[model samples]
Target: MTRAAIVGIGQTEFSKASGRSELQLAAEAVLAALDDAGLTAADVDGLITFTLDGSDEVGVTRCLGIPDLKYTSRIPQGGAASVASIFHAMSAVMAGVCDVVVVWRAMNERSQFRFGQPIARGNIPAGGGSSFMEWCLPFGAQSPASWEALTAQAYMHRYGATNEDFGLVSVLLRKHAATNPQAWFYGKPITLEDHQASRWIVAPSLRLLDCCQESDGGVAVVIAREDRARDLKQTPVTIHGAVTTLPFNHEIISDYYHGHDLAQLPMAQRVAARLKDLTGMSPPDTQVAMIYDNFTPQILMQLEAYGYCGHGEAKDYIRDGNLELDGSSPLSPNGGHIGEGYIHGMNLITEGVRQARGTAANQVANVKTVFLASGVAGAIIGAG
Candidate 1:
């Protein structure tokens, strides 16, 4: 299969604005990507996105007034599919099925639809949010915070990660975001006390600061054959190797009793193994790490499972400043979801492209491989 590269990238301001609908946000990003790619929307033949994205393929195409002719698809597994959208696009492009593919995600979640809040028990809820919500919602598992608590509790029970260790993870990301101007929490650094004292949305796992923002925005990218990308306006971020894995018994989020460990995102290990094989690279050579940050502990779990550190050693490793921007191997120097705007994991996706293109605000020197991880544990890696 031929290699695919990101030729262009675009996004709207990350905020709680709902003046524009999801479709309009998506269209804005799409049009910007097309222009950046030196291609017209008429050149787009395929569309890709996550299952959670508000804009459908036809809806985005019609809104943009693009004369699309061929492919369209949505990757499932929630926010985990953010970078996977690019992987799917690469596969399609390599197979000669589509030429210029646009991957986009749009959500008016902050205004019309909010995400980081509790479901109304006395009111309507989304379709898939039934059983689990029913069981935990009344018990104050009212939000994502509560659901993650069960797993974090289990992880702490099994191993010995303390609140300090967990604090280190958020601290590192917040510090990283402090230097990133795009971060909403930019210039704000949190102490361990700051994290600990934050209001408890879910005790023992998530706090007010522990969760991601309720964001409403959109992002899109244009991808094409690697050979064709260098001829465009900017340097292209190549797809070195991208894989998607959903472990057995994986649900949307809840995995506490499913025979899965909270300190382990099995999918990260799977993706790491595949990445090792595909790129013929090792962990030490890894320059950056960008995993999903739905909750801080998830990153801790992923760091261990991906073997950045041994099992039960991630918390310690992070405490030593291993995951900071100028540390051993930086993870999400661009604020991640917790600090950066949450357009799903699209921010991470764009950060990966920026790193590969050497345009990142906190650009890592001598960078070759850019590991762009996503999921609600979706992990994907790309390069230029």
Candidate 2:
């Protein structure tokens, strides 16, 4: 059997508005990763990306002038599919179906359209909206914040968590981002008081600061067999334990009612176990984490689900400065989606590679292993 590794990673500057097409953004990132890996389009034989990425494989292939493709695929389910794209590439390369697969995600989210605005209600069955979304749309639970707020409220109530607890996460991530030149919020760190004073987007709990930015940019990674990666331009970040798991009766973002527990993400917990089982490594072995912080509450929940802390203990763990660059867990030193640009969690994926490479702007100390999670899917990247 073959092993997979990420030999290259690249990104465009995170911005509110990128005055370019999605295809252009995708091509630029792809080319950057190829150059970083000391390879070219001719070395790529497969491609994988998010279903939401506006640029398709054919267009990106044409832009790169690639001769042919042996494999191409897309994964859906929003942010959850972020790491799943890497998982797809790993499987493809490991199984000998293809070699040198490029995984990418690019979007003109802000300049073209805003995700914060309410989605207009329509017939909506053009492979567009999920059937699960239709149930909550009529009740004004259309946007991600609104849908997630229900569960956030429940989590807060159960754990005695307040908005201040959530604010702590926002504050810490912004602090990390402040020094990262590529972060959109770079040089703009916030105080806890600032988080408290920020306006509410779906209130009683969720604040504007708690929500992630709608960024317009692109990120891409080059995955090659581990042996080939060892001979590349940079340290090979071996892909260990890439897994995606869903618990019984999983619904996309609207995981709040009936049988679904409102306080925890069961899928994430299962994924945590899967990672440990696959790699025989646990949270204590990791030097840094690049968890998806699409929303602040989810960040806390992920910490608990991934065994970094006990259930309902994440806020306290964070308050002790465990998430700081010098702290124990050292999460998302590149600012995460909250402070970094949100390209469907692709930035976090690249950050994991950066940590292992010792090239992160806000470097974690002696990082040999980096943990990454894209909602339900996750992977462990290690310097080998």
Candidate 3:
């Protein structure tokens, strides 16, 4: 089988307002990634992005003046689409459908729109928006915070975890972001008290500090065949394993309807199993974990789901300082989505690449493997 690797990574500044159109942000990020790869627009033959992205391939192609494209695709499922984009790119490269594939995500989430806001029923196009929204919005579970809280209540009840326990996840991520120059919260570390004092977005589970930032930014990466990546500008991060698992009856972020325990992330478990089967590596084997942090509870749940700890033990695992830079599992040294800007989890992918290359802002020592998990999707990136 052919192999694929990430050759370049680029992103615009993380900000509350980028003061530019989403298209311009996309173009800039794509160009920056191509430049980082020592490749030109003409070198790109494939493009992939999220269905939620406002900038389409034609718009980005026109802006970059790419001669032509042989393959193009859009992945859905919100934040899960981040790693899934890599899965598609790797498949395309391995299958010889394209030579150089650029995956990008650009948005003015804070400036132009807000994902944290409640979705009006009338605003949702008939049969177009998420099916989960239909079951949630009517019951005052309108926003992401509300839905997460509703689902997280089960875990807190089952494991006797407190809000402060979840707050610790925010505190640690903020600490990491404090030292990370690219993070939005750089040099702004917060304490457990600060996390507790923040206004509750969802009482009992989520606080303002616990929620990830809705930032205006763009992130892009270039993927190529391993043989081609060897000649690229940066140390290529090989795609050892890329897998996305959407288990039956599972909803997107608020996966309550699944016939399993709400405290457990079935999709993440499936992804972990698939990754180990594909690459013979598990979460404990990796030096770094880039788990998505749309909310604090997610980190804890995924910590358990990814086999870092046993069931109901993630709170203790996190409290033991295992998520720190020098700990057993240094998590998202780039501050993750909590401290870093949330480019809908795309920034996490770039951070994974940096870790594999030993060039991250908060570089972990001897990082041979980096694991990226976005609830339903997960991938193992190995240093090349």
Candidate 4:
């Protein structure tokens, strides 16, 4: 099969308030990525983004002055659609539906509406509501934090994992972010003690530090046919594998209804298996991971689902220093969404590209393959 490569990556400065429209953020990222690839808007033929993105593709195309668009689409898994957006772009290029595809995600999550706030009944966007939300909303499981708290508590009870265990993941990622000028917490590395001392957000399981901050930002990447990418300005990061999974009956953030096991992430596990099957590479072959850290427990759950460790072994994995930059698998070397600004995990994609190109602020050594999982989907990008 013909391949696709991410040739350029661009992102706006992550902040609590961008002070700009989502459309402007999207356009800036798109133009910056094109510039990085040494290409112009005229070279693009496809546009892909999250279904919830405030910017429309038609509006973005006009902003970029792209002559025409052969493919433009959106996927609706909310924040979990991050990796899937790249997968869709690769599929489009491979199928010859488009030549140069740009995947972007822009949001004013903090400045405009906060995702952490409780939503009124029926407020969930189209195709976003389910029996799950209906059942939980009336009973105070309104915010995303509240909905996931049930699952997080279940996992904690099952694994004997404590709040301190979750806090360590937060501490470690903040350490990585401290050195990264682009991170929202760039100079604010925290200690395990700091994490433990933080106030609780959802009682015993989650603390203020465990939750990811809402940020206003945009991130965009340029994907091109592999052959043409080799002639571009930067070393092309090859898309080795990509997969999106909603195994059997899995819900977006609240999958308690049917996740095979509430303690596990079935969608992530399915995506992990598909990615390994497609690439013939597993976690051992992975040197860097940019897993989504929307919440601390989600990071632990995804690590286990990705086969980085056995069920309930993520605590041990972290204690063994495996998540550090000098550790076996340097998880979230760029601080992930927790310490880095959250742009719906789109920032992780660009960080993965930087790792593959040996240009990251917190570069991992000889990082041939970087693993990415946005909870519901995953993809592996390798240096070619």
- Write the residue-wise lDDT of candidate 4 on 1-384 in tens digits: 789999999989999889999999999999999999988999999999987899998889989999999999998777888899889999999998888999999989999879788876845444643546767777877887877788899999999999999998999999999999999999999999999999988877889899988999999999999998999999999999888876666777778778367999878878887887899987557899888888899989988988989999999999999999999999777888889988998999999999999999999988899987898888999989
For model 3, where is the 10-residue window of minimal lDDT? 120-129
Q: What is the lDDT, from 0 to 100, of the residue 175 in candidate 3?
A: 94
Give the higher-TM-score candidate: 3 or 4: 3
Q: Encode model 1's per-residue lDDT on 296-367: one tens digit a residue.
A: 877777777777888888878887878877787889888888887788888888887787777888887767
| Residue 355 accuracy (lDDT) in model 4 | 95
RMSD of each candidate? Answer: 2.5, 1.3, 1.2, 1.3
Worst 10 residues of 4 by lDDT: 122-131
Off by over 4 Å in 4: 128-131
Q: Across residues 304-380, which tens digit of lDDT does each residue of candidate 2 receive?
A: 98898888999999999889999988989999999988898899989999999999999998898988887779898
lDDT of model number 2:
0.88
- lDDT tens digits by residue: candidate 3, 103-168: 999999999999899876623533323778877888888898998898788889999998999999
Best by TM-score: 3
Q: Report the alpha-carbon TM-score of model 4 versus the true structure.
A: 0.97
TM-score list, all predictions = 0.92, 0.97, 0.98, 0.97
**Range of the 10 consecutive residues with the lowest summed lDDT in candidate 1:** 122-131
What is the lDDT for 104 in model 1? 92
1 or 3, which is superior by TM-score? 3
**Clashing residue pairs, backbone N/CA/C < 3 A, model 3:** none
With candidate 2 superimposed using the best TM-score fit, by how many Å does residue 213's alpha carbon deviate from the native? Answer: 0.5
Comparing 1 with 4 on lDDT, the higher-scoring candidate is 4
lDDT for every model?
Answer: 0.77, 0.88, 0.91, 0.88
